[model samples]
Target chain A: MNPLWDREILMLLGGVVGLLALGTTVGLVLDRRVTSDAGRAVVVNLKARVRSWWVMTAAFAAALATGGVGSVILFGLLSFIALREFITLTPTRRADHRTLFWAFFVFVPIQYILVYREWYGLFAIFIPVYAFLFVPVRSALAGDTEDFLARTAKIQWGLMIAVYCVSHAPALLMLQIPGYDGEGAKLLLYLVIVVQLSDVLQYVFGKTLGRRRILPKVSPNKTWEGTLGGIGTATLIGALLWWATPFSPWAAAAIALLINLAGFAGGVCLSAIKRDLGVKDFGTLIEGHGGVLDRIDSLCFAAPLFFHVVRYFYT
Target chain B: MSLETLAAGALTALTRLVTGVRARWPDEAPSTSPRVYFANHSSHLDTLVIWASLPATLRARTRPVAASDYWDRPGLRRWLALRVLRALPVDRSDGCGKREALRRLIEALDQGDSLILFPEGTRGDGAAIGELRSGLYHVARERPEAALVPVFLENLSRILPKGEFLPVPLIGRVTFGAPIRLGTDETRQAFLQRARAALIDLRNR
Candidate 1:
C-alpha cells in the first residue's frame, strides 16, 4: 500500500496514453473533414472534451499512484465539490445555513473519514441511516418550518447523491474479495474506465449513427442506437480488461453492461434536474464537458450498485 | 512570483474554489483607465470575490476599498488585507471621519489605480440592496474622468455569511455592467439610483 507501482498499474496508465493518442488523431481528422457549422461546433467541443480528458486522466493516474489514501482524498474532494454544485442549485434559507455548514464541514468529512479508516459497517449506513435522520432534526431545531419538508429532503438528497453514491467509488479500496490480493484499486480503475469509455462511445455512436431518440424529453443527445453501440463496445473492452480485476471475462462483460445501463439512467436523471434548473450545464469548470458533477454523473449513478455487485459476488 | 503574488495566488484559488464564480463582462469590456467598480455588499467575502473575479492584468491595477475596522487589525488579517490583497481600507466605524476616508480613496484613484467600492457603505441583510451612501457619488463627481462600473455579485453572502467562520462552497456569479459617468447636473440621489439600478439589472442578465 505504501508504494504501489506494479506492472498492472503501468499497463493501465499505458493503455490510457494510447487511447489519448488515438483520440487526438481522430480529432485531427474531424478538424479537416467536417465542413458544416454544426459539424465544426461538434468537432470543437469534441476537441475540448478530449483536452479535458487528458487533464482528468492525469489527475486520476496521480491519485491511483498514491494507493488507497490518495483515492479516498480525491473522491472526498469530489464529493465536497459535487455536493456544493448540487446545493447551489437547490433553494435554501437562513435556517438552512448552519444545517448546510454541518453538511459540508461535519458530515462530508466524517463520511469519507470512515471510508479511509476502512470501517465497512459504518461506511455502509452512515449517510443513509444516521445523516438521514440527523439532517431533518437539525433543521427542525432551527424552527423555520417554512418549506421544512422540501429543504430537508433536498439536503438529504444532496448528501445521498454527492456524498454517499460518489464515495462508493473510492470505498472500492475497502473490498476484501477472496483470492484477490490488494488489487481493489485496479477494480476502481476498471469501473471508472468502463463507465468513461461507455460515455465516450455513446457520444460517438450517437453523433454518427444515432437517429431515434431514446427519451427526447429526458435527454436529447441520448438515443437507442448510441446506447446499444456504447454498451456493446464498452462490454467488449471491459471483458478484455478482466485481467485487471478479480472477475472472469464474461462476468466482466455483464458488470460493464450493468454499469453502462446504470450510468445511462444517472445521466438522464441529472439532465432532468438541469432542465428543471433551466441551464444547459452544471458549471463552466471543464472546457466543454461542463462541471465535475456533469462529468461524473454517470459514475455517481453506477458506483454504489457496482461496488455492491463486486462486494456481494467476488468478496 | 514574489511572496505577495504567491500568497495572492493561493488566496484567489481558495476564493474560486469556495465560490464557483462565473464572471461576465460588459460588451465594452473593462478599461485600464481609473474607474470605480461599485457593488452591493453582504459578506466579508464580497471584497475577495470581486477582487478575485477581475482579469489577471486588471487585477493588479484594481484595489478593493474594504472596511478599515475589519481589515486593518493586527497580525494576519492586516497582513492579508494590506500586503497580499492590496485593499484600500476606509475606516468604516463612526469615530473615523468620513473626510479622511474620502481623502484616501481619492488619493488612490489619483494614483491611477482603480478602486472597488461598496457604496451601500456597510453590508446589508441579504435582501434588496439598501440605499447607496454618497461615497461613490462623491468619488464619481470628484474624478469626473473616471468610469463608474456597476458590478453585481450574487450568492456570495450565502457562501460565507455574517458570523460564519467556515465558508460553505457555493456558486457565485459576478456580472460587471457597463461603465456609467456622473452627469454634469445629476444630483446625488439620481446618481446613486442610476448606479444601483445598473447593478441590479445585472442580476437578471
Candidate 2:
C-alpha cells in the first residue's frame, strides 16, 4: 500500500508506455514509406512532431513550473490567442469597429484580470450581461442603421466564441470542492491533459489504421476506429489519474468519456467553420499547429463542461 | 536598433511568409524621389506590412507618419518611431498643431524621405474601403511636388483588426496606385475626390 503505488497511477503509467510504443512504431513506418502528396503530409507531420518533442517537453516543464495557477495562466494565454484567431476570420463592419476594439483591448483584459484577481462573480457576469449590453450600445452610438442587427449579432458572436468560451480555462480557480483539499487546480490540469490527449490519440490512431471515414465533410481526419479507441484509451488514462481529481477512478473514467466526446464534436464544428470561412487554418502563429483556434477548438467545448462537472460533483 | 520596430519587422516578415504576401502597384514606374503613399488602415500591423514591402533603397528614404499621442506613449514606441522607422507624427485632434506637423513632413520631404499616410485616420473593419479623409488633400496641396499614390489594403482588416490582440494568419494584399498629379484648377474637395478615385481605380484593377 505504498502511497505512490496506487492502482490508478500504475494503470496510467502502463497506458503511457503503451501509447509511446505504438505511436513511435507507426510514425517511423510512415516516415519511411510516405511518397504521395497526402502521404508526404503525414510523413512531414510525423517528423515535425518528433522534432517538436523538446517543445512538448518544455511545455510540460512550464506547466509544472508555477504550480497550478501558473499552468492556468499558460492555458489562459493560449485561449486568448485561439479566440483572437476565431474572430479575425469572421467579417466585421466599420460600425462595430469601436466595440470590436474594446472586445480585444478592454473586454479580453477584464476577463483575464478577473481570473487573475480571483473575482468569480464578475467573471461569471462579465460576458453574458456586460458584454451583451455594451456591444449593442456601442453599435447604436455608431448610428449606422444599415444591417444594424447583423452587425450587433456579429459582435456578440465574436465575444461568445472568443471571451465567454475561452474564459472557462481560467475559471478553474473558482472550484471549491471537498476531498481534494487544494487539488482543484490539479483536477483542471487533468481534464485538459485528458481532453488534449484524446485529440492527439485520435489523430494518431486514425492516421495509422484509418480506412473508414467518420464524417468526411465535417472532419475528414476523424475516423470511427479513432473515435472509439481514442476515447476508451483516454478514459483509461483518466481513471488512472483519479488521485488528481475528487472523483473515484470509475467516476473519472466517465468524466473522461464526456470530455472526449464533447471535444471531438468541438473539433469537427470548428473545422466546419474554417471550411465555410474559405480558409484552412485560423492563423499561422503556431508552425505545424495551424492556428491557435485549430489547437484549442476542443478546449472551447470541454473546459466549461469540465469546470461545471467538478463543481457539481465535488463542491 | 529599437526593439518594437525590430520585433515588428520580424513578426511582419513571418506573417507574410506564412500567409502568402502580394503587392501590386498601379503604375509600372513608381517615382523614387518624393511621393505621398496613402493606404487604408485596418490594423496596427498595416504600417509594418507596407514598410516591409518597399524595396531597400526606397525604404531607406521612406518615412511612415503616425499619430503623436500613440507613438509618444512609451519609450519603445518612441524609439521605433524616432530612430528605427523615422516616423513623423501628425496630431489628428489639433488643427494648428497638425499644420505644424505638416511642416515637419515637408521637412522630411526636403530631407529626401518619402511619406506614408493612412487616409482613413483610424482603423476600419475588413468589410470594405472606408471614406477617405481630406488630410491627404492637404498634404498634396502643401507638397505639390510629392506625387499622391493611393494604396488599397485587403484582408488586413480581418487579420488583426483594430482591437484584437492576436493576428489571424491571412494573406494580405497591398495594391499601390499610380501617382495622381494635383491640377492647378483643383479645389480641396476636387483634389480629395481625385485621390479617392485613384485608390478605387487600383482596387478595381
Candidate 3:
C-alpha cells in the first residue's frame, strides 16, 4: 500500500493556502490605493485571479488528501475537458464525425483507464501507436478523402497532447522508484506545485519589472524578465521543498528548472495555436483562468517530460 | 423528484455536459407568455439539445415537435421521445392531410403550452437554413400572439451529423433571437422569408 500521509505534504498545502490569503489581503489593500484606468483594471483582474486561486487550492488539497485515486480522477477529468476544448476549435467536417466520436468516447477514456490499471507498457504507446493507426484507417472507411489526412491528423494530435501527454502526470502514480516506492503522490504534487508557482511568479515579476518581450509575436505578456525571475524563484522553492521527495535539494532544483523551461515552451506553443484560431480563451469554465485548457496549458507540456525524467533516473 | 423526474434530470445534465452548450438570449428577456421556439433541423441531437437548454420553468411547458415516423417508432427511440423529451409527434405523412397536424399544434398553444418547433420540417446538411416550411407560417397565423422565436443551432451538425448515433464532444452554442409576431398584411412568402432571415441573423452573433 502507498504511504499517502506525510507532514511535509500538509505543511506545503498549508503554505499555499496561507500565501493565497496573503495575496488576497494585498489585492484588497491595493484596490483602494490604485489610481488611473490601467491601474484600476489591473487591480480588478488581480483580485479575480486571487479569488480563483483560493477555490482552486482548496479543490487541489482535497484531491491530494485522498491519495492516488483522487489525483488520477482529477487529472483524467482535466484531460477530457482539455480535449473537448481542443476539438471544439478545430475545423472538423461532416466526414470526421464518427471518427471523432470514437476519439472522445473510446480513445480518451481508454488511455486514462490504462493509467488507472498501471499498465505502463501499454499506456506509453496507446495514443502514439494504437490511436495513431486507428484514427486514419477508420476515417478512410468513411470514403471522404477531401482533407482526409488533415482531419485524421488533427484528431490524432489532440489525443496525443490532451489525452496521452496529460495522462503521464497521473501516470506518475504508477512509478515504482526503488526506495521511493508508493510516494508518487509527492512527485506529482512537486511537479504541479513547482510548475504552477513558476507561472504565477512569472506574471508577478513581469508586471513589476518586465520591459523586454520574450516572443511578442506569439504572446506579448511573456517577457525575459518574467521568465528568468520565475525560474530563479521557483527553483529555489523547489529546492527548499526537497524533504517531501526522494531527491536531494540540488536534484529537486535541477528538475524544477527543467519543468519551468518545458512549461514555458508549452505556454508559447499553445498561445500560438490560440492566436491562429483567433480566440482569447478556450472556455468560460474557470473564472480567472479563462478555460481548463488555459489553466493546464503548462501542465500539458511539462508532464510528459517530468514523468520520463523521474522514471529514467529514479525508477 | 420522483423516479421519472430523476431520470429526466440526469438525462438533461448528461446532455448538457456532453455538448458544452453555451446559450445566449438577447438582452430583452424571453417572454414567458406561451411562445413558439422554432429552430433549424440539423441532427437528431437538435431537439434534445434545445429542449435540454431551456430554463426549467419554460421546459415543463414546452413540447418539441418531432416526426412520428422517426420519433414514435418502437423501442428506446420511442421511450426517449415520449418519456424524456415529451415530444409532440406530428404525422409527417398524415393520410387525412396537413390540417390535422396544424390543428394539434394550435390546440397545444390554446392550452397555454409553449412549443419547440423546427421550421425546416426536416433535417438539412447544416449549410443554410432550408426554405422555411409552411407549417411555421400557418402556426404564426393561428397563434399570432405566440412569439415566433428564431433559434440558430451551430456546430451540432458536426457533433452528431445525419444518420450517426455516436456524437463527438464539440462546443455547441444555441442563440435565441428576439421574437416577432406575424403581421396581418404580410403574405406567406414574406413572413417565411423574414423568419428565415431572423434565424440566419442569429448565427453570427
Which candidate achieves the best lDDT against the true structure?
1
Model 3 per-residue lDDT tens digits across residues B114-162: 8899988889998878998889988999888778888989888888888
lDDT of each: 0.88, 0.73, 0.86
Per-residue lDDT of model 1, residues A1-315, tens digit only: 443667887898799889988998999998999999998999999999999999999989889888988999999998988898888888887778888999999999999999989899999999999999999988889889999999999999999999999999989988888886777888888899999999999999999999999889878899999999998999899889988888888998899889988999899999998898787887778898988899999999999999999989987
lDDT at A185 for candidate 1?
Answer: 84
Candidate 2 chain A, which ten residues in sequence have the lowest lDDT sum? A1-10
List residue ranges in candidate 2 displaced over 4 A.
Answer: A1-30, A49-57, B1-45, B52-152, B155-205
| Model 2 Cα lDDT, one tens digit per residue, B1-205 | 7675576577557756633456776575556788788987878878877877777678777889999889966777787776777788778895688779878988888888898998878887655567778778777787776777778777776666777666544456788877787788899888777777777777677
Across A1-315, the per-residue lDDT of candidate 3 in tens digits comes to 254778777788878888898899989899889998999998888998898888888787777788777877788888888888998888877877878878888888888788878998999998999999999988898888999877888888888888998999989989998887777887888888999999999999999999999899899899999989998999899889988888889999898899888999889988998998898887888877788888888888899999999889888
lDDT of 2 by residue, A159-266 (tens): 776677777866775666665454445555576679878887787778767789888987888889888788888889878787767788889889988888888878
Which residue pairs does candidate 1 place in steric collision?
none
- Give the deviation of candidate 2 from the true structure as CA RMSD: 7.7
Instruction: Report clash pairs, candidate 3.
Output: none
- The residue-level lDDT of candidate 1 at B61 comes to 87
By the lDDT metric, which is better: model 2 or model 3?
A: 3
* DockQ-based class of model 3: medium
Which candidate's DockQ is highest? 3
Show where candidate 3 strays beyond 4 Å: A1-3, A31-44, B1-4, B74-84, B94-96
